[model samples]
Every structure is written in C-alpha cells, then in structure tokens.
Target: MSTSPRGRLVVAAVLFPLILASCTIDPSTGPVAISSATSSGVSLPGATFPSGAPSPTTASSPTVDTSRTTGSSAPSSPTLPSTTAVPAPRIRTSPADGADGISPTAPVTVRAQAGTFLRVALTNPEGRPVTGAFSAGRTVWTSTEPLGYRRKYTLTAGAVRPGAPRTESTSSFTTLSPLQTIYPSFFPNPTMKTVGVGQPMVIIFDKAPVDRVAAEKALSVKTVPAVKGSWFWWDDRTVHYRPSTHWKPGTEVTVSANLYGVHLGGGSYGEADRSMSVTIGPSRIATIDDATKQMQVFVDGRKVKTFPVSMGMDKEVTVAGQKISFVTPSGTYVAQEKYEVKQMSSASYGLPVNSSLGYDSRIPLAMRFSDGGIFVHAAPWSVADQGVRNVSHGCINLGPAAGRWFYDNFGHGDVMTVKGTSTRLDPSDGFGDWNISWDKWLAGSALA
Candidate 1:
C-alpha cells in the first residue's frame, strides 16, 4: 500500500539498514559463530553507526535451527597396541657344513627354537646302521654305542612342530683323532691248560679280574653225568674248581676255558684257556698218625701197602691244616727218574734230596714221581737215617724200585697221607685232600 511520501521514506530507512547488514555478511562463510554465549552485529563497510557503539545485550531467548540429524560413523578408525613379536631360529652344531665323518663317536646335536626333536642316526657312506648305538630320553636324543673305529659314518637328525611329523636335520662332523693302540690285559696268558676231574683244574692269573660273569662264561666244564660245579676266585692269582659233590671216582671229566680275550672281575682280561688231561684213578683212602709218623695205604678199603714217611722236622713241621684241595690219587708208582744221591737246595727239605714226588724243580730231581711229583722217593745219602727214623721231610723214603712200583701204579687223585709234623697245613698244600678230617673237607666243598 502507498501510504504517502513520509511513510514510504520511514520504511525505506529501516529496510535500507537491514539490506546493508546482509551485504556486509559473508554469504559463503555462513555464520561468524554458532556458539550460545556471544554474538556480534555485521554492517556494510560504507554504513554509519545507527546508535552510539551498538552495545551488545544478552538475549533471554534466542532462535536457532534444530531440525537435522548428524550422527554418522567416521571413515578412519582407531587401532589397538600389539603384545607379541616372532623370533628367529638358531643353529648349534658344526662341521658348519651338513657333512659327517669317516666315523663319528656321537651324533651331532642341533638345538633350535621350535621345541620338537628330530631324527639323528649314524650310517656308513652306504647308509647302513654303521654299528652305532643311540640313546633316547624325555627331551634329548643321543648315541648309544661308540662309533666304529675306522669306518665312515653319517648323522641325520631333524626337528618338527609339536603335532607334526618330526622333520630331519643332518650334520656332518668327524669324531676327534683316531683311537689309540690299546694293549688289553684281561685275556689269559698264552700258556695255560685245560684239565679233567682228577686234576682238580686250577688257574692262577697275573692280576685280579672283576668281570666274573665274563670269566665264568669263558670257562666250560662238561661231563657225561653233567656234573654241577663252580669257579671260586680264591684270591687275585688263584681260582679253584670242584664238583658240587665229590667227583665220581672213575668218571672222566673234561674242563676247558678260553680267557684269551675275557674281561675278569676287574678291568683285567684273561690271557687264555690252557688244556691238560687228567687220568681218573680208582678211589683209595690213606691214613696217618702224627705220633707214629706212619701211613696206611688202602685200595677200596683194603690194606694193600705200607710206607714209612717222614714228617716235617721241628722248624720244618708239617702243616697242621686239612688238605681238602688237589688230591693226588693212590696207586702203585714207578721211579720215573731217580738218583741214589743227588744235591737238593730248597729250604723246605733238610737233606740235599730235592725229589720230584710229583713235581719239577729247576734243578733235576734226586728222585721222581709219575706225572705230578707225589712219589715214594729215595735218599741214598740218608740211608743210615731211613726206617728207624721219620726224619725226611714229608716224603716216603724207599728203595728205588719200590718208588718206581709206586709211580707205575699211581695217577692223579692217588691218596697219600702224611702225619706227625709240627708245621701247619694251609688250603694251598697238596697232602691228599682227604688228609684233613672228612667233616672239614666237606665243609670246604659247597655241595658237601
């Protein structure tokens, strides 16, 4: 409506101010601030102040747009921190190369992270067992036998994950320097003999041995009756054997042993088994009296012969212990060799008559027995001292032919008893094993 010049002029003035305010506003910049606490008025650069400084005043209620929804997911998102990192595996053994030795003493062990074990084996260049021994434990693997002395050997081992098949790893390394020359002493000496039952086979080694199982296996005792027997190592040097019970008087027994490469009880090895033959003789019993210095010889309990034998003299007193050892059988004996008078020099006998009743002295015998030195011997030089006295050391002094007759009849286990001596008898003496009381002899034998 056209109100007139004044009314239109008034409306133009008010509208003109509003138009100037809009012109000064940055249309592209939208608003100067959208905050609720503060506001400023905008005016054209050429416009003049309408009133004073256009003082700001707080509005009790203000109009604002609140119609749009602006909640949406952001394009770039936040990430979390990690706690673990992987590690590299390791190698522990060497030839550094995957090579092996001509002979390896042990398998190469490789330690790596993936806590699983691998296969390690010894092989010849041809991939054979290589004579190797291996050991296995809860968490470790090792070799059992020492590697072959001079052969080429290879080792193959591997590691795999917990549930997977074991992966193999191979390492090639030669064992240290070659083995040294070893001189073994456990074997038996070259000179030894195998014996029969009558012989009471005995052995004396140079050293004590600890490998008893081995030593026993090396020894073999066989007989038709299949007698039970054992080997007793009396001392470092001596070992004796006997039947579980008394040997059958006429039964032949064979004893053999091979200790040439045997390891005895200790680190020592036996030299070898020696062989000897014992002729079983008819059983006989002999009795003697210390007070009388007399010997009664019986065959199967019948008195067949008598002999005057001397007991040990004062200092050379006869051994008082029982002879439950190597028993020389009783039989007629011949003077295999003898001397009417010969020089003797051992400290045991008073006269210079060193006779081989069943023995051999470095010096030739003044008298002799059969194979072993238990003889009815002579001492022509002691002729005056013969029958009337029991003065000769433990031997039966007789006329030469009498001794030969004794020798011709006597063999191993031929009983011969000597009594009436002041000396002592040790288990080591050979006075006819029966010389000792039967009870005591039985006590000495395990089966008795």
Candidate 2:
C-alpha cells in the first residue's frame, strides 16, 4: 500500500522493534529466533548437541552450519558421524590395584561385566606367567594353584565388547611371608623294600609345627588294598599311622606329605611335598612272657616253637641304698638289627664293666630292638636261671641252643611282643607304638 514518507516511517519503527526482538543475526550461524529456552537442535558453531537433536541453524529449519546460509534453502546438517552405540566393557581385578599380605593360596581373579575376557595374564615380579583357568563363560579368570609366600605378583586383564577393541587393566599384590617353614622326615627311611606288617608309618618333623591340625590334614596314606587306617600324634614333633590291625602281607603302601603351602602354626608354613612307598613282608611274630620265662615263635600266624629263657632281675639292692631292677620293658617291638656275635658289656649301658655286678662278654646271636642296650641274646652264664627266675640285666637271656636258632631263623623286621613286665615300654622307646590304646592314639590327633 502506497503511503506518505512520514506514515511509512512510523510503521517501520514499530515493526522493526518487534522483529528485532524475535530474530537475531549472528556472524557464524546467519540468523535465529531467540527464545527463553534453547531450541531443540539449536547450538553454536563447533558445539555438540544432545542425541536425537540437530545442530544450530538459521530461522528456517534446524541444520548444521557447514557454511553460512543466506536464504531458507539451508541443507540438512551434515549427518553427524554415527554416535558410538555401546562402550567396551571394563576389567576389574581382585587384590584391587596395589595390595599386600595376601595368602599364598588365595586366588587372583579377573572379571568383566557386559563383556567377555580376552586375556588374563598373571606374572611374578620376574615376569614368569602364573597358571590359571577361565570360567565356563569366559567372563572370569582365576589362579589354579597356590602362590609363593612373600612374593610380588602382577595381573593384567583384557576385556572386549562385541565389536570393540580390547581394554586392559592391571593390578598387583604381595603374599604373606611365613615366620618359619617345616619339612617331614618320615620312615621306613625311603629305602627299605619291606617292613613288618606291624610297623607303623612315622613322621618326624624338624621342629614342632605351629598348626598341628593343618599339618596333619596335609598328610595322606594309600594302601594298594585300601585298608582303613588313621594317624596319631605321638608328640608335637612326631606323627604315626597304622591300620586297625597289622597290615596284610605283601600289601603295597604309599604315603604322601602334601605339606607345601600348608599353614603349620604360628607364622610357619610347609616347605615342600614328599612321598614314599613300601611293601609289607611275611608275618613273623615272637611272644615273650616274663612270668613264664618263655619265648614262643610264630610264622605266618602258625605257632612254631617255644624256648626257655631268662629275663631281667626283679630287684637288686645296691650299696647306695637304691633298689634297682633290670626289668625288661613290655610292649610291641620290631627286630631292627641282628649280629652273629655282639660284644656285651655293662659299659654299653653306662655302667662299669669292671664292677662286681657287671660283666663283659661277646654274646652270640643278638637281636636288638630298643634304642637302649636291650636285646634277646645268648647268656650262658644265666642258663641255670632260664625258665625259672629273672636273673639277667635287661637282656632277654636265652640258652645257646635257642639263641642260635633265633639268629638263624628270625629275620629283620620280625615282630617281638613282651608281656608281664612291671616296666611298661615308653611310646618313644624302640618300636613301641602298639603299646598305646587305639582311643588314646586317636586322642592325640590334632583333628580329634
């Protein structure tokens, strides 16, 4: 509509103020309608916009400013590179980051969520790889065996999303150091081919272990025939195993000391693992009755022969006003060593051979059992007392005929059981393990 210059000026002034308030001009984005709240896709140059929203544009439609648009025909914002859909999973480790004083047996584990484990590498400070296993789903890895004490270990784990690069994470920890370490020294000495069926397996420790329960639990025994047996502690430093009855002849037995990594007690742990196997020989047993003054021999459960013998003195009153008796100890024993002719003297038992009550002689047919100087040997001097009275030192005195027979027929590892003596065999004396009752034996077990 044509209007005078003064009327046109008035209309331009009112409309220009309103238009200026609604639309704003910018150097980078050309123009935009300013609002109290931001437009859904509107943003400055190089500024990031939220997902599902477009970038800032001129007043026509929301579009990115690839170049300043002077008209309504602005092109669609250059399709933003497709946003990352899902991030790769992260790795997490046990003994998180840098830990210390870990147990040697505790597992070092790595796991992932919303992803799968690609690699799990655990190594010692020297970079030696530790052995481990992966879970069925491959989402976790754990150590298979025990770690070393006072050692530093490093762990690195990698995880990946379905189509993402592997992401790695690392951690480290140290195991606790033991205050001490122990090892077992058990018998049949690891060399004997055959042992008496009555012989018990004995384990002697270098020192008393701190945790007897753990130490005992670490030991095991397996017989080829699988006979039932149990372990008993004779003392803090020693343990023994035996069947309910004597082992069967020709039975093969194996003993394992799986002490390594076992916590022994206090701060002590086991040092190493050990194993031994032995065989049981023929069954041969000898029974002696101090009251009857006789020795009965048995072979393979059959009674063989009997011989008249003399045992230790009932009592002897000495000049020092001391009543001393050379009573033989009564208990089960094994013939450990044999001698065709062994020199016998009071000096061997810490007595003066020259003394009036002592004698020195070369005794024939000696089978020694007790660690003390006790033996079943020929003592012809006491022949008159044989089968009648107790008249020798602690030796089981036999006639020349009987002694020679035993020396020729009795083999090493044969059993000998003494009865009716007032002096009981000490559990630690010779092979007197059978003297203890089964219940008493079991009571000594740490597990009990």
Candidate 3:
C-alpha cells in the first residue's frame, strides 16, 4: 500500500508493539515465532516468516532430545571382564611321597588346607592299619603308635569342601634298617625289683656305644616326689644314675631307655626301647672302720646292730707279674648281689691256687660289694680273728651268725661305707657311684 510518510509512521507505531509481543529473537538460532495457544515454536534461519502460528491439536510429539542431532551415534556401554570359578582345597601328607630311611619315632601327619578331613589311614606291610586320632574339626590326623623298624608304611588321606568333591593324597615311607643294633640291660632285674636307697639306676649296653653322649641322652630317670639326679657314664657300655643324696626311703623310680631309632655313633643303632620301675625299701646302711675292726648297721639313720668284722690284712703279694693288694679299697659301696654260698677263688683275680696267698673255698652268706672280687661273707676259719685282727684276702670276715643276720636283712642298693684304707674305690667298681662328689657327678652328665 502507497501511503504518505506521515501515514506510514502512524502505521509503524501501531504494529511495533504487536510484532514485539509475537516474535522473539534467539542469539544461537536467529528467531522463534510464538504460537498464540502453546506460546512455543522453533524457526530456522531461512524458513518462511509468519506473524502468527497455530498450536498443535494433540499432545505435542514426545519432546525430541535436542542434545544430539541426526548424523551422530549413541555411545555403547563399557565392556566388562569375564569371571572365573574358584577350585576346591587340596590335601597334604607328611612324610613326602616315596620317602625312605624315616625315623620310626617320627610322627606321621595329614593336613587339609581350608577344608575338613574326610578320611585318613596309615597301613603297614601286613595290611593292618596303624592307630591314629583325628584333630578337632577333622582338619588334621596324627599316628598314635610308633612304627616298626625296617618296614614300609603307606599313608592315605582325603579332604573335602562344602558342595565340592573330595580330594585325596597318598604317601609311602620306609623306616631305617640299622646296621648294628644294641640292646640295653637294666640292673636290679625284674625278679628283685625292690632296692635300698643307695641303689642307682644302671644300664649296660650289649655293645659299646661310640657316642656316649647320644646313648646317655636317650636315658631318663623319673622318681616319685621328684628327686634331683644325673647320669654318669661309667664306661663305654655302662651308665649309672644317682641322686645328689641317697634316695629317700620308699621312693618310686622309673627308668626309661628310649633308644629306638637313635644313632649311637659308628654303624650302631638302638635295638629297641626298654624301661624298668623299682621301689626303694627301708634305708639300710652298714658302716665299717678298719681301725676299730667293727661294723655298725643302721636302719633309717638309727643304729640297729654292731658286729665284729675282719677286713683285708693290708698286704700285697706278687703273682703272675701282678701285685695283688689284699687291702680292700675304702670308699662308699652298694650291695650289688647276694648268694647263699659263693665260691671264692684268688685265681679269679689272676692269682693261682698254687700261690702261697691263694685259696679257693665256698663262702656262705656272701654279699658282693665290688667288681674286684670283694665281699662280706661268713668265714668260719677266721672267726677268732674277726674283732682282734685283720686276716683273709680282700674280704670282710664275719662270724657265721653275724653274716647270716646281714644276709637276711640287707639287699641290693644297701649302702656300705668303708674307712681307713690307702686306696680309694674306683667309681666303676660295682655300684660305687656314691664315691663321686655331687659336683663331679653332675659334671658326668651329657646334658649338663
């Protein structure tokens, strides 16, 4: 329409307000037209312009996400690593499979890792099962008894976890076969188990042990009420144990030589274990004085009887290139053995019967006190010299009645202390362990 300038200004002024209310400009998308009903619509830069737009009749199509436009793709979820199943626990056995030369004393054991034991067995060569016990929770098993020497043994064990199959394992081992085996013999044989307080625990090996310490280590002494004692190696084959003082009367003692499977040096091994138990009877001690030529007997520290005695004559004689002293060595001694009628012969000590000082006779009511053929016996021939003079070879001569009384009253382990002699008793002579001082006795112990 061609209108004058004044008319155009008037029209522009009237439409300016309406246009401003209908159209809005966006900085990024240029301009947007407003629908009268919905009041929202998007307009592209080059689209046809409209002063007003109608609202859609139905609910507007679900709002399209304008964040992503048409030529772009959606991102995929991150890939996850695959998972694996866990295995069940395994069973273990000791000694390892195919082991040989195992000690018979060593314990056989079975264990399970993070599982409970299902079954365990150890079988000997004879197809017999060895005794064993299971630990709490059934997780471990151990053999209860020692195995046999030079024998093969088999072990089998099984364990399982919840909802899993049982896992089993097997092992085989062989015990050592010793080249030489030595057996130990204990003193105070089983027949005469009761002994005096001075009696010591003695063990004599059939074969001399090269490693005395090893042999000593295997020996043990247990006394009721607990007595302090130590073992002394008397010789290669003999070891003796004594208390610091005389064993208390009525004490019970148990000795163990647990030497099985012990390597005792050289090619020797212990044959088997041995044990002995003995009870100490009433304390009976006899003291003899060479100067007084008298013997006093005591029971439990109380003097009970006194008798005349004739000790060795304190004479030395040369026989077979050896000087044989008739004087009995003085020291502490223990009654080792008793005999109703013991045969005495100087020839036993290298003196022949033809020699002037040699004599062979059967003596009655004899008790041996030393390994060197010394004894206290009934001597009818020397009865007159019993109290007044010292006569007879290395023996204490007692009247028949006195000897009988001693034989009837005294037994093994009874103490016999002798005084006034030039020579001292050797510790290895009979049960002469009391001759050693307490300090020296402890020094003899292997463990000490």
Candidate 4:
C-alpha cells in the first residue's frame, strides 16, 4: 500500500525490532523462548511469524538442550544430599547358650573391660530390686553373702565406654537351694595396739587372712613420740608389730591389730581386737663373731666385754648371719668329766650313743644342743684348737679362764650372738637372730 514519508518511516523502525527479536530469541514450543512488547503488539522470538504476513521467513531451531536450564530458562529447584544416622553398640556374648535346668545356688557374675562404669541391679519375679547384701569393687561386683535359697534373680546392667553412646546389658540367674552360707567379709573392724615398755604386742586371729596386703593396711600403730616400725605376719592368723630397731629404753610403745569379720583363708576369721603396751628395758645386744673368735657385748650401743670362745669345725661351722640363734631344745643333763684316752666306743654313752657325731672328751662340760645327746662340758683336750683353727665337733669349746668368765656373766635373757661361718640358717633353725633383713624376711612370707 502507498503511504506518506513520516508514516512509512515509523513502520520501518518497528519492523527492525521484530526481525532482531526473531534472530536472538528461542521458540516457546521447544525448550526456551523470549517475549517483547512493542507498538505493533507482543512478539514471540525464535518462533514462526504469522502466515502471509508482509514478510514470511522460516528460521532454524536452536540446538535442543538435554540438561535442565537454570535462570532465564525454566524454573530451578534446590536439591539436598541423602542422609542417615548410626546406632549404638551392644553386648555380644553372655554366660552361655541354652543348657538345661540349672541349680539355684549357683552364683552369677557380670564382667566387662575397665572404664565401663556398669550399674547392676537384680530383681525378683515381681520386679522388685534386691538391694541388700550387695558389694562391688574396682573390677568386680558380687553379693556380700550367698543369695536367697532357690530364688530366681534377674540382673540388668547398663554401661558406657568413655565417649561412647550409652548402652545396656542384662542377664538372668536362678539360684538353687542353699548348700553353703558364705559370710560377708567386713571392714573397719575394731583394733587394739599394745602399749607397754616391755611388751611385744602381737595380734592373734582365729582365721588366717587370705589377703595379707589388705589386712595389714587395717592395722595401725604409733608411739607417744612416733617410732619407725613394721608389721611381721608370723602367719595368716597372727602378725607381730616391732620397731625397725628394738625400742629405746624407757620409751612407751603401743601396737594394734585391726582384724574382724575379714574372711581369712581356710574358713576362719580373726579373733577379738588386740592391743598391747610395752616398756623398753636397758639396752642389751651382743655380737659373737667367729672371725677373731671373740664375743663382744654391747649395751646402749657401746661395747662392754670381749671373751675368747671355741667354735664348730669346718664340717659343722655355725651359720652365717647377723644374729646368733640359740635353737637348742631346752633340757637338762648331768655333767660327765672323765678320761677316755682309749678310742671311745659308741656303746659308752647311754641313748643310742654315736661317738661319730660327738667328741670323746675326758674333761667334763655340760652342754645343751639337742635333748637326746646334749651337754656343755669341759673340753681340756680341745684347748689348743680353740680360735684360729676350726675344731671340736659342733659344740663350742672355751679356755678355762674365758669359760669361767662366760659362766659367771651369763644370765637368762642376756644377749648371746654367734655369727660368721658358711652354714646357711635353716628356716626351722632357731639359732639365728637378724639373719635376714625385714624386707627379705617379709619377701619369704606366704602373705606377700
């Protein structure tokens, strides 16, 4: 159609915008599209124009997109990763699998690795918790005594390893009729320490304790002015309390043995509380060394007298140790002084006389070694062999002068020591004092 110049120009500008939109836009029928409004009207780019229009042209479609489009295309929705949670741990094995009808008297136990603070509870058929007669320790928990006769017990325990999620474990135990009544081991039993200057306080128990380590801890002792001391467990049933050194003269000493209700081994228990007082007497310590063949007496840490003495032969040397043990079985015998110049016969002595183990002495001396054949008699023949040379069977020989000195000075409880030799002290041999250090002695104890 024919038109004025100004109107024609306006139409040309509008046409230019519509054609440009068609080139850059996408088709709405396919994956994407763009729409624009102009004076001519709304126009859809990247799509077919109206048929028979002033200009009709077909354009190629955009490459189809398989992946979903984002902004400026279709809508986009947020996505979240899949998720799940972990569970807790549980016990794997228990007492056992199905067995048979079990006895009710049997004891039940629960155990686990350390640091698992487990709370255990037992309940009856009616769901009531059995609370009394229960005990527990660092590694174990058990009934203080036997459980009720022929009773059904349900136990539940809950525990958690450090930093682990809390978990629970449970089991059931049926006890048969009571066959034994095991008593509970009790603590904090009463204690008594002896306090006397001359007393060696001792604790005597009816039952030997099984755990000496624990029992010793229960005992306590202290002097008015504290002294160094230790516990000597004579046996499981008895313990002696003594100072490292003897008590100082005139010092007051007290000792106690705290043992009660502790289950000593062999189905026994400790006796009543024990306390003793001791009064230290004058210092009396004697040392008899085979070396130099002299006996030195000491009082209050000062030497007093020295005496010459005879000793056992190499075949029967005195034991080697600090103290001299007089393990002689006490008995009496008449002193026999005679001259047996001729080779003595075994038949000369009364009781199964064996001259082999005894010296055929002519000068009589009464000696005491064993009850059967014991005597401390004169050995004038052994005078030259005293000291330097090891001679005279097991009996100690003495010179006439020194013998009389010892005979006159000696009294009951007067210190006597015999040391130096190759013989080892026999455990049952009582002839030794200070034979071993207290620690070494304690090491030999079964209690240790």
Estimate the TM-score of every prediction.
0.42, 0.71, 0.78, 0.39
lDDT of 3: 0.73
Name model 1 segments beyond 4 Å from true.
Answer: 1-198, 244-246, 258-262, 265-279, 284-286, 315-343, 346-376, 381-387, 430-448
Point out the higher-scoring one by lDDT: 1 or 3: 3
Model 1: lowest-lDDT 10 consecutive positions: 51-60
Better of 2 and 4 by TM-score: 2
Order the candidates by lDDT, highest first — what do you get?
3, 2, 4, 1
lDDT of 4 by residue, 1-448 (tens): 8899999999999999676554433222223111110001011111111111110001111111111111122122223222231122232212221212222222333333332324555455555444322234322233222233334455554434432344444445443222222222211122322211212345655445666665676577777667776666555566555565556666766555543333333433333335555445556554556777765766667887765656656652222332322222211111112121223322333312332453343444343322223233355666787656656544556676655554444322233445665554442232122344667655643445
Report lDDT (Cα) of residue 86, candidate 4: 19
lDDT of 1 by residue, 287-403 (tens): 556555456767755788775544333332232342221222333332224453444443333222343332223322244433333445554544455445555434455544444
> How many pairs of residues collide in model 3?
0
Off by over 4 Å in 3: 1-86
Instruction: Please write out the lDDT profile of model 3 over residues 1-448, one tens digit for every residue.
Output: 6899999999999999776666433323322111111001111212211212110001111111111011111122233222232234455566655666766666666666666755666777765666667777777676656666677777655556653334555567666667788889999776667999999888999999888888888888898979988998887788888889999998999999888778888867788788899999999999988889899999999999999999888799887588888887899999988899998888899889877887888889999999988898988889899988888787888999999999999989999998987788987788889888999998987667
Q: After TM-score superposition, what is the CA distance of residue 47 in candidate 1 from its true location, in Å?
A: 99
Superposed on all Cα atoms, the candidates' RMSDs to the truth, in angstroms, are 32.0, 16.5, 27.9, 29.6
* CA lDDT, every model vs. true structure: 0.39, 0.70, 0.73, 0.40
